[model samples]
Target chain A: MIRFDNISKRYPEGRDALQGVSFHLPAGAMAFLTGHSGAGKSTLLKLIALLERATRGQLFLDGENLTRTGKRKVPLVRRKIGMIFQNYRLLFDRTVFDNVALPLVIAGHRHQDIARRVRAALDKVGLLDKERALPITLSGGEQQRVGIARAVVNKPPLLLADEPTGNLDPELSRDIMRLFEEFNRVGVTVLIASHDLDLIARMGHPQLRLHQGRLLNPEVLAPPQ
Target chain B: MRPPAALRVYFLRHVQVALNSLGRLYRAPLASLMTAAVIGIALALPSGLYILTDNLQRLGSQWDGGANLSLFLRHDVSIEQAEALREKLAQWPEIERLRLITPQEALAEFRQLSGFGDTLDILDENPLPAVLALKPAAEATRPEAAAALKQRLQALPQVELAQLDLQWVKRFNALVDIVQRAIWILSALLALAVLLITGNTIRLEIQNRREEIEITKLIGATGAFIRRPFLYSGLWYGFGGALLAALLLALAFVQLNAPVRELAGLYESSFRLHLLEPGQWLLLLLCGALLGLVGAWIAVSRHLATIEPG
Candidate 1:
């Protein structure tokens, strides 16, 4: 679903976040991206989400050349993408249902369809009961689940999560990882960026390791545990 | 054929979000009302001043009590000569009409109207002078032309002093013109003030919801969708302010209407003061709403571009 030919990103402040990075994740495939802090993992994910553009090279997202995409078309391109953040990034002032309903709302779905899909996504993440609760009132794990539900509510063909379980305990982290696997199993391409080498190794998905803005390894593709 | 399902979805979502934000405003009555009141006050002052200026302009133009000039002939001028001078002036193109009022004629008219007939008749000799009352031509009715005609009449050997009744009208016209200009300038400045106030309010709202905007952008919310609520907020602010201003003007009109009518009646004039016209009221509302929408749009475009979910 994503192909990058030596993508490089350099900020105006003389910081080179990524350089000579290239990778391809086939449709319906799932993979983990492991890198240290500032290892260009977030930058790569941003490139995929169209939040940040590659300074050099071409990127093909679902066979569409995103490198030539105009700013006005970015939002339309992002419709097929679901992005998650380490902070969960849920709107704290809103309830769980509202947070989960955001993607569908952004997609301009009808109210009934939005409600049904949001509930179903929340149920999938095991947080359907907490729909009316505020994000501030939820536990760290439950909040992350809410984020997951929000990400999947639109049923995006591509999912990108940056430290999805960053704040969760080991058990909750495993549960989050399992949720990702389940989505992947259902043919949604998933790419997760994390610094947790052990958890990623145990998950047994293919790994794309970034070191010093370079793709040191590509496509581990070990069978799932 | 049925309409596209996507289009139906979009319409429903728009209604939903717009009503949602409106409900949000209703839920927090005090703060919302405060903002609206500020907008209303800003709009009301200029509108009231403008309406006042309009009525004053009407009154000023209606002061055409006829630009009549009275010339007191020299004491020694005979009634026949005064009559001859009147006849000569009557034929002039500048003179609309001329009447010779002999001393006795003036005295008799004064006595009948002044209710002091006996007192005036007690005098041994008539003290009133022969007077020539003249109305200017249509083109000479303007203040400058009337003054020029008066100057020419004063140069006549038989004329003593020329009194132009249009002087007070000239002064009043000048005063009204100044007031109208001042009101227009005030309206422009206050309109700008309204724009800034609304823009600042929208900017602050965007700042408060920065995270939400960023998240929405990341979730593929289009530019129009993201801007919809803020635009509506501005519209509400403008509309609410306009209503408040209209209400204020109405109240002011009510309190002033009776006194104005009584004053006009005292002067034996039929002039009546009225509030803003119906068309004017609609225009004010439209201007307010338009300003609100523009202010919000500017703020959204400037700030929303900076917020990205990276």
Candidate 2:
């Protein structure tokens, strides 16, 4: 669902964040973006999410040109992609249920539909019992699950996670990876950025590895097995 | 037919956000009340001045009908000559009506009012002069017109002195005009002050919720969605300030009404202090709320644009 044609991003201070990166992951494929810290993994995902614009070349999502999309249409495009952050990014002041309902609320769904979908997503993430509990009271892994529930509540076709399991223990990290695999089995495209080589090797997902702002394996189009 | 789903969602979202903003204000009662009190005092000053000027204008206009000129005849002029002069002046178009008070009538009035009846009887001759009390026509009661008529009467050969009794009324009207201008200036400045206070308050709120705003934007929340709550907060501040202002105005009116009425009674006037009409109060509230909305809008547009999901 994502195609980057020789995309290069240069910061205003003349530093290249990504250089001549080209890749394509067909629809219904899940992959890992493996790179060292500051190896431009986040930048690639940001380009796909339209969080940062490419300085050169073109990028496309679902056959639509993202590089040509204007600022006003960015929100509409973003609604099609679910994003999870390493920090969980949950509003600590709100309850778990309220946190998960945010995406549906932003989409202006009917209140009843929002409640049903949010609960279903929470149940999937094993957070049904913590719906009314504040995120501050939840464990790290639980908080990450709340973030996962929020990202999936709207049923976006593409999911992007930036080191989502970075703060969890190995067992909890494995559990989070399993949840992503479950979503992929149902035909949702998933791209996760991470430096956890051990967990990624065990997961056996094709890795779009990057090195020194360049993709080391740009032609790895293997489907998720 | 029931409302469309999108419309219902939009309306419900607004109601939710508005109530949520109000609840936030309730959460910080002291700070909100202090800000609203400042706005209230600012609004009340201009409102009170406006009412005072309006009442003063009404009082001044009430005395417009009493515009009169008094012409005293020369001591050497006989009553017949005085009567002839009065008849001649009475025929002028500017004179609505004129009454000639001869020396005897003047002396009698002075004696009755001055409380010097025995002393006045001790004098062999009366010192009073024939006076013509001239009431100008309604149109000629204007200050300039009456002044011109006074000058003409003073130039008459039979008249020794002429005085326009409407001088004080003209001065009072001028004073009222100046005060009205001052009120306009004050109101404009205070309105600006209200805008700044609300803008600053909303700016701080946006800063406090910066993380929430960034996350909301990341999750595809439109600019309008992010702006709704801040705008509602501004509306609440404006409405609360206006409520407090209205209360202050009502209290001031209550405190001053009795004394004002007593003062008017002392002058044999039936004038009473009047408060704002219902529509005027409604307008003040509307203006307050509008100012708050505009202020919040400005702050939101300026700050929200700079915050992106980096």
Candidate 3:
């Protein structure tokens, strides 16, 4: 449920990061955002996340105008959205259980609720046995699973992943894609940004491609299997 | 779905997190003790100066009451003339207390007080003049009033010379003023030193924990959320430091109390050192907490902005 209407972003050094980009994805829909390096994929995601303001034009999330939202309200808006990073940004100093519990903690969940939800999310990632292990002790694939578990722990309506499997092997990448599909099947809107065309093609999801800071084409919905 | 009492839950959670950070401090007792000790020493310098000033003020107030002026009659004046002059001077509204000493009584007092009673027995005639000791009202104890009164007494026909005993009081007041100004300057310098010490500590902590902070931000943790624990840690440092400083000051006062009491006894007076009042303790605690909070805030604000999530 995000809409970017002719949004453009220009850095102070006169470099255009995003130029006249526009797109819309409906509620509970899953799509893959693809572009080459410096093609403005991150800029588009940043605009939607309200981490960066657009230089021109309006952007909306779930029908609320993000372009007009003040700085103080950004945190509240972000609380409703979950983000997973390519680096698997687990807190190395904390246990796997604590890493997954972070989103719920930020959402101010009760202790009991947080424990229950975190355990369930960890179970979903098949890491229930390693709950007490630190991220540094985990394999790369396991760390990514921790990131995924954290993203879904809050049960947010929207999930954004920036190159979720960019650092994973082919087998692990497929497994992570399956994890995203499972969440999408349960009605979470998911948008993943990546340069992995083959992976997107294999997943057979709708594609929104970006080229030189502009949306290159309308949504190319996958044909029926 | 909105929870019925989410804000209370959130506040409790924040407190829990703060306590958890405090627990970490407790886990490393030696490091915690050293940090707190440094903070205590920084706090103690000013606090000790304040106590000293307070005690000096009390001593000054006690001595202020004993200030008096002595007027000696001329050698040719008779006892009856000196008595009449004393009675007339006692009528002045500024005079609080007065005593007339005849030449014979003055000579006797000098012999007893100066420890020359045996030697004075051999003298044929008394050399001391009739003396009038006058204690002025509190408002009239200023240097100007005492000088004017001395001039008036000296002009009397029955008087040889009038001497004001206010010189000691003036010197004591001057010393007290210098001590007070020194205390103010010392407190100001020590406060600045405390701020710098706390700031440097927080800066080092930031450098050490840079990776953890970057990771937290990358996971969408708000700056406030990431900064909360560090703030609490700073608060703990301040609180612990102030408590130690207070204890150290109290111990010092305890150590000095006996000697001070003995010295006062030598002068046939009872003097007791004053401990810190409740208000002073509260002020110390407040100062510590504020310093910790400010130091941590400055450190976090300066370094947190430079970290970017890749």
Candidate 4:
């Protein structure tokens, strides 16, 4: 669950990355943040992840005021939100299993729990057989799948993917989108930031569009007025 | 969780990380050994100097001339009177033991030692007077008390002169003190060198792993988690260096042992270099490990804060 109340993030160089964007997505909702380049999609995701602070207004995620949450509590907040980047961001030296096990390890889960959860997540992403292989050995789509498995391994209540399929072909992109849909069916709130409007529109999920750093149509998605 | 339970888990994780760090080092043996070897040499110098000074001081203290009081009898005192005087002096609490040397016995020892045996035999009258060699109580190690006791011996009717033969002992004690101070200064400087070495190494490590660190932070790894491996690796470096230093010192001691013994024999001295005690060795190891930890900590605290996930 995320609620942004007129959040505006201004960079130090006097550029407004996001301008007064207001929206609320309730629990278990899946949506795409559709926008062009520099339309503040990544910035919005970053603000929600507490990677960047809003220059003005507030952000609330799962009942906690993220705008006011200090840096010390950022890690605890982030533990609840799984994140994926376009580049996969997987450690090249780590094996597939290790990348998937990263979140559980950070949470201090014991060996047995981490192993079991990591294997199940890998199985869901169809990467179980490549668990021992390093990220460098994997294909682009397979590496991105490893990133997906890692994001979901911890079973975080919320998932944020920034350009998850930006590097994949159309078919692989569809497969990646299907993986996200499977996660959403089990009730994890998912927000994806992407510029692939045609592909996202075919999925028929609710869309929150941004133009020139402004939420184009907050009225369509704001919960109950 | 209860505090004890939490602490136990925390320590277990730390131990795991420590071993993992060591494994990582083992994966790069040459680099790790080279770093540790430098640290080892730095540590070994001070440890060797400390042991050397310690042995010298021990040797000087064993035959402590400061504990001895020499009482020279008057020339008029007969051997019987000198024997009576020794008995009288031996009864005092200050005198632990006293041995009387009659003039005839003294003359014979002088003739043998002074290398003028034939010349001394031609003299009509032997010049050496009867003497009593007294070992004072343990309290006489204090120079003032020894001097007071010497004055008491000189006041005796049969005694012509009494003095403590501890001038060389005092000089040796001062020399040992100076050596100890110098060792401390050298140790301090070398400790700084070790700290800088470890700090620079950790800094370079953090730089090489910048991308890994950024990814870890992005995936919600806390600062403590990111720091654990580095700190443990630093400790391993220290631990390895300390072991190497101990090994080096032991080898040196073995090589020097026979020669030292031979030299002592030539001087007719009963002194031999004592091997390092267990406690001293433990302390050296601890010092090396602690220096490594501190160096790593300093580097991490300074650099890790600058690396934040974006």
Question: What's the residue-level lDDT of B8 in candidate 4?
Answer: 68
Ranking by lDDT: 2, 4, 1, 3
Which of candidates 2 and 4 is the stronger one according to TM-score? 4
Best by lDDT: 2
Q: Write the per-residue lDDT of candidate 1 for residues A18-72, one digit (tens) a residue.
A: 9977778888999998889889899899988888888999899999999999988
Docking class of 2: medium
CAPRI grade of model 4: medium
* Backbone clashes in model 4, listed as residue pairs: none
Contacts from the true interface found in each model, as a fraction, amount to: 0.88, 0.70, 0.30, 0.57
DockQ, 0 to 1 scale, candidate 4: 0.66
RMSD score of candidate 4 (Å):
3.5
What stretches of model 2 exceed 4 Å from their correct place? Answer: A222-225, B1-3, B64-166
The per-residue C-alpha lDDT of model 1 at residue A222 equals 23
Question: Interface RMSD in Å per candidate, to 1 decimal?
Answer: 1.3, 0.8, 2.6, 1.2
Question: Compared with the true structure, what per-residue lDDT tens digits does model 4 show for residues A38-155?
Answer: 9999999999988899999988999999988987788899999999899999999888898899999888877788899999999999999999999999999999999999999999
Top DockQ: which candidate number? 2
**Rank ordering of all candidates by TM-score, starting from the highest:** 4, 2, 1, 3
Write model 2 residue lDDT over B247-287, tens digit each, in one string. 99999999999999999999889998999999999988988
**Model 3 per-residue lDDT tens digits across residues A101-209:** 9877766679999999999999999999999999999989999999989888988888999898999998899899999999999999999999888989988888888
lDDT: worst 10-residue window of model 3 chain B: B58-67
Residue-level lDDT of model 1, residues B1-310, one tens digit each, is: 5479877776777777678767877887898788878888889998898888788767754554456789999999998899899889988899887888899999999999999988987899988999998878867766788889999999999999888887675876677778888988888888888888888888988998999899889888888888999988888888888998898889889999999999999988888886787899999999889888888888888887888776
